[model samples]
Target: MLVGYARVSTQEQETHAQTDALRNAGVGFIFSEKRSGGSMAKRPALEEMLTKIGAGDTVVVYKLDRIARSLKDLLIIIERIEAAGAEFRSLTELIDTRSPAGRMFFQIVGAFAEFERELIRERTRVGMAAAMRRGVKMGRPTAMSEAEEAEAMRLWFTGDYTKIALARRYGTHISSIKRAIKRYRERHQPSLLDAA
Candidate 1:
């Protein structure tokens, strides 16, 4: 049995190209998803397809990245397919994990992924270090000034108004009001508890 998997990262994207490719590859059953590749949890169809696939079956995908974005993720899925006594095939890359050559290619790809990750980490560290040397502040920009935050806390501590009412009065979101109050309480908490 040959089963197909097709994925599109966004709801607005079409899976037609991948589906058509899978059908052309002679896949009898197809599972498609319109979920991002960042999280496997969002792809229910892929999960169901994995559950249904078994030994002696072939799982076909249009592209390697269509199945998974990272090498580690690709390896995990490949391991699952191999453990199930099934084969994995990628139409675009012409990879067939049932063959020895294909397995070697997969290892090569995994090495590149690891190299790429290391490069990314190095680049990020260098960039952050440069930013620190230049005294460039990083992190969320304050939506409200310190004075506004203090005034919001003062109003809240007086117990004269509800959170929603305070938010409406100050023309700020209720969430902002709640966060301000939370931060204020955390900062003013007794030091005895901190020692404990």
Candidate 2:
């Protein structure tokens, strides 16, 4: 049995090209989905297709990314297919894991995925370093002004109010107050050491 799976990120994006390719490849059953790959849990048709496929069957996909976004996810899906005693194939990538050459190709792909991740990490480190050298500030914009932060700190140090109370008085969440307290303690660590 040759089972096909087709997917598109949005309803506006057509699946005709994928379905047509699957039909041309002689798929006996085609399970189509219209959802982003980011939300794997929301893919009902994909889950159903996996449950329905059995031994001696082949699950065909138009492309690798159409089924899964990352190599980790692709490996997981491939592992599931193999565990079911079935084969996996991608039409565009020409990856047919049922064949010996296909297995070799998969290994190569795995190496490439690792290499790509390393390259991304290196590039990100370089970019961040460059940004720092240029005095570019990172992280989220401040939710509280300097005056508000000072007032919050003063109230907190007085031990007259709980963290929750301070947050309520400042019209902010408790989490914000907690973070502010943590930051203040870290900044004043030298003073604390001297006092001790």
Best by TM-score: 1
Over 76-127, each residue of candidate 2 has an lDDT whose tens digit, in order, gives 7888889899999989878889788997897577557657767987999999
Q: Write the per-residue lDDT of candidate 1 for residues 26-140, one digit (tens) a residue.
A: 9998999898987777889988988889989999999787888777778888888888889998898778888799989866865675677679879999999999899987876
Each model's TM-score? 0.67, 0.57
Off by over 4 Å in 2: 1-81, 90-94, 168-171, 190-196
lDDT of 2 at 94: 87
Worst 10 residues of 2 by lDDT: 106-115
Regions of model 1 farther than 4 Å from truth: 1-46, 62-73, 169-173, 190-196
Clashing pairs in 1: none
Structure candidate 2, residue pairs in collision: none
